[model samples]
Target: MKHYDYILVGAGLYSAVIAWHAKQAGKSCLVLERRSHIGGNIYCEEIEGINVHKYGAHIFHTSDRKVWDFVNSFVEFNRYTNSPVANYKGEIYNMPFNMNTFSRMWGISTPQEAKAIIDKQKSEITGEPKNLEEQAIALVGRDIYEKLVKGYTEKQWGRDCSELPSFIIKRLPVRFTYDNNYFNDLYQGIPIGGYNKLIDALFEGADIKTGVDFLAEKEKWMSMADKVVYTGAIDEYFEYCFGKLEYRTVRFETEVLDTDNYQGVAVVNYTDRETPYTRVIEHKHFEFGTQPKTVISKEYSTDWKEGMEPYYPVNNEKNQMLYQKYREKAQQQEKVFFGGRLGEYKYYDMDKVIASAMNGWEALHR
Candidate 1:
């Protein structure tokens, strides 16, 4: 039997990066992925010459220079800025609650005019905001909240604004400028070709085995390696000893349209309570593809259950306390290292995930 220095539980970005680093350090690694393929949630499928995001929309944006440079080394990225449009009952407006949105909402051009309306509406909530509804109104005023925030948030969480906690939406950014850029990060773009190129580069020298469940035969796999790097749900690793952590999962309905274009932009968010799905994404627009046919995916947020692909972690008071218990138990395992969104039980963007993986590698070496 072959012995290995490390056994990675998941072949996602976190594990891929660690595997790459281990190979460079003259160490042997065995990467076991539960999914049939690698790249985790960032995996994309090409249909009609277009790279469709299989899981959901993942735009790489980061303010960190080192992180940006690190990813660029693997694959080139296209200049695709995320300027999502929100459609409220067929009415279109720019995202991030910017000046373009205010102008269309109230037909006002100046920032002062927009500010006056928001300030007046915000004053209605005089006392501390009790729930998400009041909290949103206090932050960006009633008009923006009603049309853009209320229904969309409710649909995402599967709960009404009144019932949801205020902490979920601490603040809604209301930009006074005409810029429609969704992110404030310095570097923002999509990987050219697709995210698989980056994943392929990361897995160049690593021994990867897909469609294998490490947790099923934990003792057998652990015996092959000196240490284990787990990236799956921490709760599941312990067989739900402290109960499962709550997560919000999304379902995608994708189709190839005959027409070259469907929506002009990459993302169009349906911000009305009546709309069943939250957003419709045009995959071609993400890479500026000129394919004859276009592919689109309608995203619907649903309550997560066991055996489902978990997306957003619910970091509420109850779940947080439970995760901490799992964390304490995880720390006691001297031969194991927990990382990634599910492992850490925290939401992270693509760049942040890469940065985290690099940090984890450094920690292990030092």
Candidate 2:
């Protein structure tokens, strides 16, 4: 049996960050991952010299300067602004409903013209929105709602906009500026090297055991470590005593083309109900690299079932209640501290996952 000061139950950014801190604090650590490789959800594989995100697209965007600086230590990042395109029945439009999208929709260029168009559209809706469709029309008006938001949102949730809650759509940001930058974060980019390489470097000195099931040897593993940092699904950690929480999942269909370029953009979102898939991603665009061939993947959102990979937590009231019950159970385990997206049942981006691990390490002292 192996032993260590701390046993990290994942090899993702969260576990890597925690292991880094544990090593800095003079604590021996062991990281266990069920997958053959590290980097968890952010793991990327090379195909035709292009690094394709094995999961879905993971763009690094964060407003936290500390999180940015922390990630920069392990790997240098490249300047790649996210400018996703939306396809509505073969009619492509710039994403984020920016000035360009506004002009295309209304044949107007100035901010005032765009506002007047939106105002005229909003003036027709007099009643309170009862569902997502109504709410989207109330915010961005009918034309933009029909073309851009409706189909995509429905595809993502696997439900019609009319059936979904109004709280889901809430407000659609219609920017008056010409900026196509998807997120308004201060820092946004991709790693110079693939995420897999960065994770390997971060775990160079740490004892990591991939393809090991922590649950199978739970008692033995727990006894081997001085403390436990669990990063698996919270309900599974507790054997689903309170019942499993619902989640939304995504399936990816990848294809390698012999051509130099598959699509010009990194991500092209299909915002029409006619298309079964939600988006198609060209991996090379993320790194701005030119190769002999290209790799592409079509993403489809689906309902999560047993023995399938769970992506997003169903943050509805029912799941929230179930998570709260699991959280209470977790708090009672004095020696085990839960962290990361799966462990906490929260949706976390790349930077936030790293920051969470750092914070988890600090809290161990108190």
Candidate 3:
């Protein structure tokens, strides 16, 4: 019989932001999370004094100053820059395809020498690239594409480059500089005490319930609130009237190592076709931990089913069309509003999700 101004579903970044704004506006809000805990994929657990990124490695990087300021308000971020290395058959190279990588690969130092080498190799591709393989070759040439791109991309999508569409990799970033920083963002770092600090701060004024499936008892929850802000799968919200949308999920295999360091860097991508997992993440490196032991997670990409934890939205032609239909149906519902990665059927970074939720809150208030 308790009335609430808003019933926010999912308790992820999107829902947390909405609930925060709702509190600021003097509105009573309730957050219902299907999982046992909050923070969604960004949730971290402390093991051996190291915060393990449970789902996968989530590096918070954003060019937006507003979003940067917004998140920093909750928790202070450490000066952690993502400079991932690629291990191709025991040979290591820096990521973002920079001059350092070029130097290591072909003993070329200057940008001019690297450009010439790439340009020469790129010329091999004839007019109008058809597939991801051809498009990548056309962009950065065969050497970089073969060693760095092909296998990693193949593992991520669970498909070969030739079979996938060119639009999947519209542009392979080829940095001519010596910069190995993965992102060109103005603000980037991991939260000092892990992402849970931020999530806990965000949900301060909201009533939260975990291990509760909103869809199971939809009507009961819906009646308590004036409006429902759903951040779960859009198809699930509407009972998949237009069929299910496809997604690429990830499986994490985490281990506690006896040694201080497992991998020198935070992220090391295995760019070999034979490698089962795409990347190995050393969690301690993310926070500059000098612990006696370290925790690492090997990430494997998999096809998402109804019960699996959906990670990346496969925004291909068919899925997009189906999502559009669901979106239309969502808009027709007067009391329900959809947001976040799953609800929108789009891949969004953490910063973008926060900005989106803030925007959604503003729109709802207006």
Candidate 4:
């Protein structure tokens, strides 16, 4: 039997970063992936000479220099900015509620006109915002809320806007400028090739075993290392003794089109409730590919069930309290360290995941 310093439970970004840190510190690691591939949700599959984002659309955008420089060292990122368009019924508008969107909606120009319209409509919500509907109206006004926010959000959470909590729509981006660039980050781009290249680089020296379930042979795998870095669902790891944590998972329907330009943009969100899917992602636009064909994935947001792959945590009072119980139980265990979105039951963007793993690893050694 071969023993090592660490055995990572999942081959996602958190595990990959920890593995990278271990290699940097001259330690051996054995990485185990439940899936056949290594990159987890960030993993991409090549379809029609385009790197299709296997999960949903993921665009890297961050202002942190350390995390930015670290990933760039592995592969160069293209100048791909995320400026998604919203398709409501048959009409299309720019996302993030920018001036361009306002112009398209109201047939008016200048920030003054947009502000007047929004502020006038925002007056409808009196007192404290009671629910998502009120909160969204207070932020972006009734017209934008009805046409853009209400239907899409209802589909995403699988609930009426009035029934959902106000905290969910605490802030919706409304820019006065004409800039349609979705992110305000200093740097935003995709890797020169694809995300798989970055994952491969992060785990250059680690021994990886894909298509292996670590939890099935939990004891046997635990014996292979002094400590374990687990990136699976924390509630699942504990076997739901405290009941299952709720999540909002997405169902992807991806296909390759014979024509190159399908949507003419990377992301086009269907804001109308009539549409089954929330967004459609055209893979080739991320890299400015001139390939003869294009790949697209339609994302449908739904409530997560027992066996579905959990995409994001459903933030609410009930789930948070339940996660706290699992967290306290996890602290009692001496052998395993839990990290990542699912493990912690919290949403984390890409750069934040890398930064969190790096900080955790450094703190562990210190």
TM-score of each: 0.99, 0.97, 0.99, 0.99
Query: lDDT (CA) for every model shown?
Result: 0.94, 0.89, 0.93, 0.93
- Superposed model 2: Cα runs more than 4 Å off: none
lDDT of 3 by residue, 180-266 (tens): 999989889999999999999999989999999999999999999999999999999889889999999999899999999888999
Error of 1 at 263 (Å): 0.4
Candidate 4, residues 169-230, lDDT tens digits: the string is: 77999999999999999999999899999999999999999999888999999999988989
Error of 4 at 218 (Å): 0.6
Better structure of 2 and 4 per lDDT = 4
Clashes of 1: 0
RMSD of each: 0.7, 1.2, 0.8, 0.8
- Residue pairs in candidate 4 whose N, alpha carbon or C atoms collide under 3 angstroms: none
TM-score of 3: 0.99
| 223-334: candidate 2 lDDT, tens digit per residue | 9998999999999999999999988999999999898887689999999998999999999999997898889999999999987878999888889999999999999999
**lDDT agreement of model 4 with the native:** 0.93
